[model samples]
Target: MKVKIDLEKCYKAGECYYNHPELFKMGEDGFPVVLHEEISDESLIKHANEAIEVCPAVAISLED
Candidate 1:
């Protein structure tokens, strides 16, 4: 899976970070900073899906 976050669509809600800190981190400005953009592992997909669900800005996305 490939993951991406649109900065223009992000409003610094930080839910994505909270849901998947291993791959998503909150910057000093409180916006999400993508730590990993390409995900091939099965375990991380679970967190990625949850992050997508909790992101208020809807900035997180996953592509197969």
Candidate 2:
């Protein structure tokens, strides 16, 4: 699975970071930054999905 974050749509709310700190990072400007392009591990996929779900701006997406 591949995780993609639409930077333009992100509000920099930091929910993704709170959910998956290892997979997501916050930029200095406060936008969500994807740490990895692809998430193949099952455990990590769950966290990535949680990040997507928790994003208030609906900026995160998963592509499989």
Candidate 3:
């Protein structure tokens, strides 16, 4: 699975990082930065889902 975030739709709200600090990091610019493009950890699916659900800008996406 892979995760993608739309910068145009994102507002840098930091929800993704808040939900999954181990996976998402706050970039110097304050946006949620993906540690990796590919999601291999099955345990993190729920966290990713939470991030998508809580994102105010609705920018987070998952691809299988």
What RMSD does each model have against the real structure?
1.4, 1.1, 1.1
True lDDT of residue 54, candidate 1: 83
- TM-score computed on alpha carbons, candidate 2: 0.88
Candidates' C-alpha lDDT: 0.84, 0.85, 0.84
Tell me the lDDT of candidate 2.
0.85
C-alpha root-mean-square deviation, candidate 3: 1.1
Q: Estimate each model's TM-score.
A: 0.83, 0.88, 0.87
What is residue 32's positional error in candidate 1, in angstroms?
Answer: 0.9
Better of 1 and 2 by TM-score: 2
Tens-place lDDT per residue, model 3, 1-64, is 7778899999888888977897799999988788877887877777788888989999998899
- Candidate order by TM-score, highest to lowest? 2, 3, 1
Candidate 1 lDDT, 1-64, residue by residue in tens: 8888889999987788876789888888887888876888888988888888888888888987
How displaced is residue 27 in candidate 2, in Å?
1.3
Question: How many residue pairs clash in all the candidates, one count each?
Answer: 0, 0, 0
